[model samples]
Each structure stands twice: as structure tokens, then as C-alpha cells.
Target: MLNPQWLRSFAALIEQGSFTRCAEYLDLTQAAVSQHVQKLEERLGPLLIRRPRQLELTPAGHALLEYCEEVSAADQRLNKRLSEHDDKHGEISLICPGSIGLALYPMLLNLQQTNPGLIVRQRFAPDKEVLEGVLENRFELGLATLKPDDPRLLVSRFTEEPLELIAPVSERVEGWEDLKRIGFIDHPDGRAMSSRLLSRYFPEAPGIGSLPCHGFTNQIGLILEPVARGLGFTVLPRSARLAFQRPESIQVIEGPRLVEDTLWLIHRAEWPLSTRAKLVVKTLKAQIEGLSLRNHACRRA
Candidate 1:
């Protein structure tokens, strides 16, 4: 490998137009600058034409100068990218369950709007897919209902999302019998969430599968549509229920037992999060906390 100092001296000699001037610019002795040129020629050969009162470049010298220019350009680009990476700017990729995505997507968009430099990329996925995305390096952050036990992950409790039993405003639900009469509007997590909440509230009630299926939808935004139209009842996370467009059309069934699902925030433990991703995580946590407080206040009222 050629020495970088020698290349620097050679380039500087050409730019300064003389050995004496190159030595002055580089804070080196004239003998040192000349020696650099000598070493370079010994390694590559015939780099310059020593003309009195003028300096001229050989073909080899021209090639080396071009290589030096390319290296300089690449260095500049690397520095620019590093600067952007350290700032609160650039893309932040995250994957989360559909329920949280419904609530968090709008908040993420609002954050991007305020910051202008941030580009948010969010995906709606199940817990399995969320974990996979983070582990595979497709996402910088992930939110899951279950805490991952993988040692490769760094997990923390982000927030708790309550599971709400919802039915049309016109429907009256007083007991398990009422739910059975209405039938079940099932979604991807309908059975799981219903099982958890119903088992706690009505210990005598059968499993969620016992209820006749009224309708089904996998879309988080549309999960409450059938319930809102008085078709049936369903259980969902509070975030999903709140994101429904026609909130007045449906009601959350109040019960003695309250069930909440713990949401976990996850990222790879091997690599630290970028500045933009850390900012996004911090902003999301703050917003969700504020929203949770507001909901608590409303429930108390």
C-alpha cells in the first residue's frame, strides 16, 4: 500500500506549484516534501518532469491526482451522511400490531409534520411479524403485545392498552347471555382478547368460541364497523376502538373487572438505535402517556 502522507505531499506540491511552497503549506521541511516525492516515484515511478521555474506532471502523476480527487469526493459524501445520521433527520422504520398502528400512525404523521426532517415508515403487523421485522433488521423499532424472551432483543414496557367490550349504542348488554344473544364480531385477535376479558369478568361463561360468529374483519380500522351498525359485539384494544370514525355509534361495555394488555417496545440489543429512531421512540412514549392520562380523566368523569 502507498503511504497517504506521500500522496498528500505530492498533491500539495502540484497545487502549490513548488516544493518550497508545498512544504510551507503542509508545515514540513523542503527536504521532507522532496523525500515524499522521491518515495512516491520509487513506488510508482516517473511521476513528474523537473522543469526549471515550472512544474509539469507525467501520465502517472495525472492518474494519481485523479485518484486523489475521487477519494476527496467520497470523503465529503461520507461526512455528510454521518452528519445526517447524528441529527434528528432521516428515515425511521417501525413495525407494530394493527391496534396500536391505528392510534400511533396519526401521531407519527403529526410528528413528521412538525419536524419536517423526519420520514416515518410504519407497518401494521401481528406480534410474530413485529418481532421478526426487528430481528431481521427490516425495522429499527417494534411494538408487541407480548414481551419477547429473545436475548437478542431489548424490550421494555411501553404502555398498557385496555381491552374493551364494545357493542352498538342501541344494544343493552347486562350479562354473558346478552353477549351470546348478540353473537360475536370476530377479528384476528377477537377470540384471544374476548377470552381474556370475558373469563375475568364472567368466570362461569364459556370460551369465546361458543358464541356464534356474526362477522369478521382483519382490518384494524374496520373491525368496529359491524359492531357500530348493531350487527354484533366484539372485544378490542382501547386504541383500536378509539380510532373508529363513528365513535358515537358504539359504546364500551363497563364491567367490574378491567383487562389491559401490556404493550412492549423492542429493538435489537446488538446495535444502538440511531438518533432519529431514538427521537421517535421518545416522542411516541410521551404522546401515548398523554393520551392514556386523557382517557383516564374521561373515564373518571
Candidate 2:
């Protein structure tokens, strides 16, 4: 078994991604940090730290972090329970991706309006990194769009965001092949999502050269501005269209079957959820379920 003290140092190192920074922040010598990690490896019977160019966590290191987070959460709950003599009010930390943050954050703030005792800490991350932060005890909850089939993650289906291929109606495009002519626009993460989306449609893994596109932009919001200005067509979540503030800026291609991103509310299954966390989860479920495609624009905003 790894010592809790050692686990603390390990998590700190992993978060900082290096021993020197971890040692400096934790007020421990670099040698001492390295020793703690070596001793931990001795207990684990294998190298958990990959100390090549940068501080990379070996697969074992990742597994240990997950275990440490569970223990840490349990310890926190115990501390809270023992101090139950105090007031019931406490803070709830949350991490979410772009779409949900813009949409649900306001409603969540309103939940605490009548009861000012509740505290909330919100953090924004992309879809994939949000889950990693949650599993590592960085946040109590994460709102994400993609969910892997991991039993250790408890996921609640909160919202279904419709995906659409939006284009300037003046572009004189009608169907999928028109995209071939205009060259599909790329968002910041579109290279990755586009590969995933294409693989789902063509499982044979067609060569990228066979169906090539032009120009990649790292910003999703920027991609839309160009598209509205007659640059090129792009695929985006329907909720994002609310930014136009006018009907003619874009047109949504309907019924041709674009990718659908189902948003899930994710939290570690092993962590003991607090009362505030549970209440927020329930309220989010109720609110998202009550919202239909029409109300999606409202929720995203």
C-alpha cells in the first residue's frame, strides 16, 4: 500500500508535471520529492514515474492517482461529518465544457439566489480533459459531451445537443456534395472530431487524401464568423447558432443525419457525494429533461 503522505506528493507532482515545480510548491527539496516517488515505486514493485523529457505518469501512476482521489474524497466527507455541529452550508466545485457552461451556469446561480448559503466554484475545460480532472480529484463534478464505457464513472444523461452543418444560405449549396466543393471548415478541435465523425460514417478508414478540405482554425467561434461572412460551411452544435442574433446569417441542413453529441453529467462513482452535490445533480437532471430541442437554445445561452 502507498502511504498517504507519499500519495499527496505524487498527486502534486502529477498536477505540476515535474518534481522541481512540485518540490518548490510543496516546500520540499527536489531530492526528497524524488525519494518519496522512488519509495512509492518500491512499494508498487514497478516504476510508476516516467522521468524522460517531462514528468509523465506511467500507467501505474494514473491508477494510483484514481485510488488516491477516492481516499481523499472519503477523508473530506469524514472531516465534514465530524464537524457537522457547524452550519450546513458549504461550497460545491464544478467543471464543465464550453456549451454547458454558457447554458447552465446562469440557472445554477439562480438556484442559490433564494438560499445564499450555497457556494459554487466553476471551472471550464474541453470535453476530454474535464473527465481526467474529475477522476483526479480536481473537481467534484464535470459536465461533458462524450462519455466512455467506464463502469467506474457514474453518468447521468442531462442533455441531447443536436448537431448541424450550418452554411451561409447565399453560398448556393444544397447537399453533402456541396461541402466537397466549398471545402469543409475546420474548428480548433475539428480535425479530431472530423476524423471520429467520418469513421462512424465510413468504417473502412478512408485515406485523408481521398476526401481533403482546406483551412483549419483553432477557434470554434471564429470559424462561424468566417462562415457567416461566406468563407466556408462548418459543422457545429445547434445551440451555437444563437450567437448570430439574426436568422439570415446561416442555414441548418436538416434531416441529412449529422453527428449527435449527447452531454452527460459525470462524477466518480466511488466518491461519496455530498448533499449539495446530490441536490445540484438532481436539479440539473430535472432541468435538462424538461428542455426540448426548442429550449436547447435557451439552455445553451
Candidate 3:
């Protein structure tokens, strides 16, 4: 079995670039840190390092650093798991976009109410950050619109959230011409969503940047505020539209059906998710299905 203590010392030394500093951080003597590295090297082969005055890593050391960090993180997670003595109660860490998290909050609350022993810890971030959190094992799962490009991640199609063109309640939108005239308020995902929307509805329209962009904001929940005040129109996912502060102040424009963003649940492929994590995933899947069914019924009615 691999020694987590030795791996921790190796990683700390690489980060600090000195046995003395690493020892100080770990509350161990400098000699202890040196011995830890020597023991690790004996077992894992030479993690080559060149030292004159300052420390420098060889190619082998550079490669080993990534694995060591991963192992150290895994050890930390394992320790936390062991501390939770009750198998019936555990924590699930999740990361998702702000808008999606808002949309799912009610269902999450209901799940928690039903199973009081299960704890769900959630953080809202941009899609990129959410994916990074999952890859780093900081979160057990991530809900994101972007597909995972890394082979190390396992992604499952969560839901296809339809995108809608929205404008202030006072404005009347007929089609693409009105959009061109009114201009747009850009969000973080605005450019990409605009590209896909124009491609689907206005095939011959100019490039996304050619359109008048009033301003840009990275906050999804706040992106529609300007649009609602009649500053401009914007395309946002259904979840974001619902989460907007003034949903009644804005209305979805009637136009050709546009593209939708697919939210996928992403996680590290090799990590075995805890039972609470699995339960949260199942609950989310059911909630999405129910939401879709409700929307479909509303459309029919």
C-alpha cells in the first residue's frame, strides 16, 4: 500500500521547494521530511530532483507531482468519510451554475426534508469553475451546460433546457428584425448562446458580435435585469428566465424555435461516489423529469 504521509511530504516539498519549509508546514523536523522523501523514492523509484542551492524538479518529479497530489486529496476525502461513523448519514458536495442551482433549489430542499440524514452542500459557480471543482474532487458532482472534453471525466446528460429570447414586458417582439433593432445585453454565456440561436432561427443573420451589445456581466442571475428594464433583449436558458428577479417584468418573445443548452452531470470517472452522492443524483434526475413533464403539459394546455 502507498504511504499517504510520505506522499503528503513529497507534495509539500515540491510546492515549498525546500525540506525546511515543508517540515515547518507539516510540523515535522527537516530530517523527518528528508527521510519521508527518501522512503517514497525507495518504493516508487527515483523521483529525480536536482539541488544545488535552490530545488528544481526533474521530468520524473514533475510527472509524479500530479499523482501525489491526487493521492493526497483522496486520502483527505477518505479520512472525512471515516469520520462520518453513521452510514445512514453522509454529505454530498455539488457545484452548479447559479441559475441552475436556483431552479433546482426547491427540489433539493424537498429531498433534504424527506431524508433529514442526508446533507447536500452546494456551491454556485460558472460552468468552467464547476467542471474544475469536480475534476479536483472538491465537488462530488457538477451540473454544467458545456460537455466535458477530458477523458478522465464521466458525464451524463442531465437535461436539455430550452433557450428563450426575452425582452421587457413593454416591448413587442415579432421576429429577428425586432431583435436586430432592440440590441442585446450580454451575459457570460451570451456570445455562445447567440451564435447557436442565430444559427437556428436567423440562418443568414450576421455574426453574434455584429449585433449591438449594451453591456456584459458574468453574473447569470443579474444578466436579465437590464433586459427587463427595456435596455435590451437577451437569450437565456429557461431556468435563468425563471430565476430572474423580475420574471413578470419580462416575457419570452414569440419567434422561431431556438437551440437549447444541455446540462450534464460531470464527475471524476475513477472516483467511487458516496451513497449520499448517488442519492442526490437520483433525486436530481427525477426532479428534472418531473419538471420536463410539467412544462410539456403546460404547453399542451
Candidate 4:
């Protein structure tokens, strides 16, 4: 009998490209991931994986990948259908940007409180990682600022949040000179967003080279702190502003209002979402809509 556990490890290894990364993604030891692949090879003949320079799946390994994916998809579908009749709601896993997750977490908590049977797990990941997580069945759904080009993933507009250039309350930003003097606090999406905003708003400076960055942080929540302490300015979405604990410490710098960033909900096109997962998605959509409306009202007021 084929072990689903081993197949899962193999699939992760294939997607992640390295046993170490696959093990990290799957929360398994490196030795364990290797062992799982070895077991599969033992059962279904040699599944040679090229190593040393780079890892490449052998012909057998590639063939096994298709079978494993199909089997996993079928199993998930069957399990989803079976669980519909059960009294308890199954788990729902989601990956989203820190900003979106911060804004939507309250609604999720309220949902779990009302429906005790449902359990929701949310993790903050970069846009790229979120897309990969949903594609690999590691997450049921994902929210991201950027959509992947892959046709296999279904993308839908979630909501648009206003982006603002923020600086310490003490600093003043008027033109290129002021911006260059203040510097920038780089975050995960900072470079891309900053570049686009600069190109549109500040025509004088062509690229990011004109505005130097003092430091960088992968953690979105922490990105604002440095700015608050008068370190450097950063551009962030409205949701991020709402999530920031001390908004009073920083001020929105007066500048050209660039286009807002649209957050997208993404999932694998082929995979069927479980009933509980579907419910979570619905809740998230409604909450996001309400948030957009509120943001609009705030802007008008």
C-alpha cells in the first residue's frame, strides 16, 4: 500500500527543490524527509534524485510526482465530502500578508467564537510564498498584494487599500531633497511600491537609488517602528496603518496619491475547498468589503 505521508514529503521536496527546505516546510527533520523518499524508492523501484551540484528529479521521480499529486487531490476531495456530514467543522488553513491578516484577524476570531466547531489557522507570508503555499495544498487560501502569472491558480479581487508615504511626525517632506535627507525604511514590498510611487509622484528622481535605505526588515509590523523613532520614512498600506499600535508617532507625508494596492485572494484552481474553508473565505470577503467601505468613509470625512 502506498503511504500518503511519504507522498506528501516527496511532493514538498519536489516543490521546494531541497530536502532541507522541504523538511522546514513540512516541519520534519532532514533525515526524515530523506527516509520518506527512500521508502518510496524501495517500494516503487529506484527513484533517483540527482544531487551534489543541484537536485533534479529522475524520470521515475517525475512520473511519481503526477501520481502522487492526483492521489493527494482525490484524497482531499473525498475527505472534504465525508466531513460535510460530520458534526464538527474541519480545520481551515490560510496564508496572507501581515497587513491583511492584521486587519482580518478580529473577524476570524469572532467567527470561531460563534462556531465553536470551526478552527482557523492563519500565517503571515510574503506574496510569493502565499501563492506557493496554496498551490502546494499547504494552505487552503491565500491573500496577496500581487497575483501570480500561473493559470493554475484562481485569483479574485479582495479589496484595495490606500497607500501612504509615512515619516516621523517631526520631519517634513516636500520634494526630492527632503526625501533624500529623510532616507527610507525598507520592508518586504517597500522596494517595488516605492519604485512605482517614485516614478509616478517624484519625477525628479528616476529610481530608488536617489532615496537611500537605512535598514530593511522582513516583518511588516516592525517596519513602522523605525520610522516612529525618527530613523527613516516608509510607504505602507492603510491596513498596515490601522494595524500599527502607535499611529500617532508617525505622520502621513504630503505627496502625490499613487494608485492603491489591490489585495487578491488566491487558491489552486483544481483543488476543491472544504465546506469550512469555503465558509472562512466568505467571512473574509465580507469583512474585507466592510473594511474598504470604512476606509472610503474615512477618506471622505
Candidate 5:
């Protein structure tokens, strides 16, 4: 491989039009410049034709010069981009579970609206997909309900969302019998969430599979639609429940024990987050905290 210093010297020699002038420009002795050119020729062969008045470039020299120019230009562009990298701009690619996405997507859009230069690309996925996307570099950030065990991931608790048992406003949920009678509106996470919350509050309740499936929808936004229409009850994170279109139509059944899922934020452990990503993370945390506070206040009232 040709040394970059040799290439720099060669480019300078051509630009300055003399070995002496090039050496002066580069703050090196003329011998050093000559040696640089000699080494380059040894690696790449016949780069320059010596002449009495002026040095002329051979075909190989011309090619090397062009390559040097391209390298220099690319270096300049990279430097400029790095210098300009700040919290206000750039793209943040993130993948997260659908429940958080339901609440976070709109807030991220609002952040983009306020910072026009910041571009947000968000995907709704399950915990497995979220972990995979981050590990594969498909996304710069990820949010998952389960903490990944992979050593390549840098994980931190972002927030905890309470899992709520939601039913049509008219349904009175008193115990296990009430949920069985109301039936179950199952989504992708409906069974798992129901099992965790139910087993804590209603220890005698049979496994979630025994409940009659009143409806099923994979779309997070529409998961609560059945419950809102008085079709059945379902379990969901507070974020999803808050994002439902008809919040007044469904009620969060107060249980003796509160169940919450900890949302973990993950990224590549080897790479530091860009300024723009840090900004996005900060904004997301603030918004999620506010949501939690508001929900808690409402529950207290």
C-alpha cells in the first residue's frame, strides 16, 4: 500500500510546480519531498518524467494524482460533516415494540416538526425484532420490553409502562369470573401481558388460553378497538391504552397489584450515539416521563 504521506507530497509537488516549492509549502526539506516521490514510484512505478525545466507526470502519476484528489475531497467532506454534527440535525433510525410506538411515533413526529433538520425514522416491531435490528445495525436505536442478553448491546431502562386490564366502560370487573365472562381481545402481546397481570391479582385465575377469544388484532393502534366497542376486555401497556382513539369508552380496572413492563433502550455497545440520537433519546425520555406523571395523576383522581 502506498503511504498517504507520500501521496500528499506528490500532490503538493504537482500543485506547487517544483520540488523545492513543494517542500517549502509542506514545511519539509526538499530531500524529504524527493524521497516521498521516490517511495511512491517504487510502489506504483514510473510516476513522473524528469525534465530540465519542469517535471511531467506519467500515466501512472496522473492516475495517482486523480485518486489523491478524490481522497482529499472525501476527507474534507467527512471533516465538514463531523464538525456540523450537533443535536439539532441528522437522522435517527429506531425500532421499538408496537405498544410504545403507538405513543412515541406522534411525539417523535412532533419533535421533527420543531427541529426541521432532524429526520426521524421509526419502526413498530416486537422485542425480538427490536433486538435484532439494533444488533444488525439496521437501526441506531431500539426500545424493547425485554433486556437483551447480548454483550454487543448497551442497554438501559428507559421507562416502565404499567400493564392495565381494560374493559368497556359499562363492564364491571370484580374478579377472575368477570374477565372470563367478558372474554379476551387478543393482540400479539395480549396473552403474555394478561398472564403477568392476572396471576398477580387473581392467583386462582386459569391460564390465559382458557379465556374465550372474543377478537384478535395485530395492529397496536386497533388492539383496543374491540374493548372500546364493548366486545371484550384486554391487557395493554399504559402507552397503548392512552393512545387509543376512544379513551372514554374503556376503563382501566384497578387491581390490588400494579404490573409494569420495563422498556429498555438499546444500541451498539461499541459505538457512541451521535449527537442527534442523544437528542432524540432525551426528548423521548422527557415525553414518556410526562405521560407517566399525567397517567398517575389521573389514576389518583
Candidate 6:
């Protein structure tokens, strides 16, 4: 019989594509991941992985990945059911992009005050990780801007936010001509998001309208500090823009806007929401929707 643990380790190896990387995910030594794969292959009596190559799966390995995904999903459903009936809402984990976490996490914290007993674990990750985590049941809920795939992962878009242009108050101008005068404050990933959004909004615009984009920071909040000091301007989603406390010094320009990005609430479609999970999502929607209105008010005020 193939060891289930070894199968799981092999799954990790497939995901990481190398023993060294799998070691980090499983918190196991590189030798251990290799040994687990070796044990798995021995039990099967043939080569599972095409070695001397970078973790290419043989036909057997391909068959095994499908089996593991099904088993892993079932195992998670069983665990969730057991936890639900135990009167332990226990820990409900939700993973989302860092931008959503900034705008919506307070609502999660506020939920604790209402129940006083439910445990909420909010994990911040990028968009792709968040979606995959939801699909794999690594998290009960996830928020992301995704391409929208899979019936198992039900996604409900909550809002679409436009990107706002910002420049230093000192260099603030009312038009696009002024936007071109100073260098643009480009957040590495933020620029990519903006580029995609712009392409989406204006497919026939003039030659992609070049801007001097620079600066690499993973944190969107950090981008504002330099913008406030007149460094340069960048386009960021409205949700991320609200996180910055300083609004007066930084000018939000109307010349160019980013394509709206979708914020979807996701959960497993096959499983009913846990009582606590239902409550959390309810609270989240109300909070986020309410904030959307308030944000509009603030912008218009």
C-alpha cells in the first residue's frame, strides 16, 4: 500500500517542483522530501517521477496527482463536518490579497466582538494564491481578482474599483499635460494591474501612452509616503488608496484612471457554509458594502 503521507509529500514536491522548495513548504529537510518520493516510487514498483529532470511527473505520477486532489478535498470536507458538529466553530481561515486585507480586515476583527468566541484567522496572500487556497480548502473563504474558473470555487464579485492617479500636492496639475511633467510613482505589481486595466478600458488608445514608471514595493500603503513627498505619481486601486491616512498632501488627479478591478467573495460551492463562516461572510459583505458607500462619500466630499 502506498503511504498516504508519502503521497502528500509527493504532492508537495509536484507543487514546489524541487526537493529544496518542497522542504520549505513541508518544513522538512530536502533529504526527507526526496526520501518520501523514493519510498512512494518503491511501493509502486516503477518510476513515478522522471528524475535527472526538474520533478517531471511520469504517467503514474500524473494519475496520482488526480487521486490526491480528490482525497485531499474529501479529507477537508470530513474535517470541516466534524469540527462543525463539535460546537467548536473553531478557527475559520480566510485568505485574500493584501489590498483586500487592508480594506476589510477590520470588519473581521469587529466580528470577534459580536460573537466573543469565534476564532477568525485572516491570511494575506496574492490573488492567485488566494484563489488556489480556496479551491484546495486551505482556506474557507478567499477574496481575489481572478480570471474566474471552476464550478467548485463559487465567486461573487463585491465591487469594482477604479485606479486613481496621484501626484505630490506641490506638483499637482489639473490635466494630463501636468501628469507627464513629473516622473510617475510606479508600484511594481501595481503597474502591471494598471496596465491590464488600462488595456481593458482602452483597447484602441494611442500606443499605450507611456509613463516613467518606477519604484518597487510589495506594500501598497508604502507607495503613498513617497507620493506625499512629491516623488512621483502612480495608479492604485481605490481600496488600497483608502488605506493611506495622508490625503491632503497627495493630489488625486482626474487625468487618467485605471481600469476597474473586481473584488470577489469566494467559498466552496459543494459545502454549505459553517454557521460561523456564514456569519463572517455576512459581516464582511455588510462592512465592505458600507465602506464602499462611505468611501464614495469621502471622495466626493
Per-candidate TM vs. native? Answer: 0.73, 0.59, 0.70, 0.70, 0.73, 0.65
Better candidate number, 2 or 3, judged by lDDT: 3
Which prediction has more favorable lDDT, 3 or 4?
4
Scanning candidate 5 in windows of ten residues, the lowest lDDT window is 77-86
In order of TM-score, best first, we have 1, 5, 4, 3, 6, 2
Query: Model 6, range 1-301, lDDT digits (tens) per residue?
Result: 6688888898888888777888999999888878987887776655454567566667777888888898899998788677774323566688987777887777777776666666778887888788788888888888877656778877787667666666788885754455556666666456567567545544554412475654556675687888887777776777777788988888766544445678788888997777777777777788778887887788679
What shift in Å separates residue 191 of candidate 6 from its native position after superposition? Answer: 2.4
> Residue 144 in candidate 2 has what lDDT?
82
lDDT of 4 by residue, 245-298 (tens): 998899986566646888888888886666677777787888888878887788
Kindly report which residue pairs in candidate 4 clash with one another.
Answer: none
Q: Please state every model's RMSD to the true fold in angstroms.
A: 9.1, 12.4, 8.8, 11.7, 8.6, 11.5
Q: Mark the regions of model 3 whose C-alpha exceeds 4 Å error after superposition.
A: 1-79, 83-88
Rank ordering of all candidates by lDDT, starting from the highest: 1, 5, 4, 3, 6, 2
Candidate 3 lDDT over 51-136, as tens digits, reads 67577766667777888877878877797777454434767678998778888877777877887876778898988899889888
lDDT of 2 by residue, 14-56 (tens): 8888888999989999998989888988877554546575766
- 4 versus 6: better TM-score goes to: 4
Q: lDDT, candidate 4, residue 6? A: 95
Cα deviation of 46 in candidate 1 (Å)?
30
Task: For residue 73, give model 2's deviation from the true position in Å.
Answer: 16
Model 6 compared with the native: what TM-score? 0.65
Instruction: Output the worst ten-in-a-row residue range by lDDT, candidate 4.
Output: 84-93
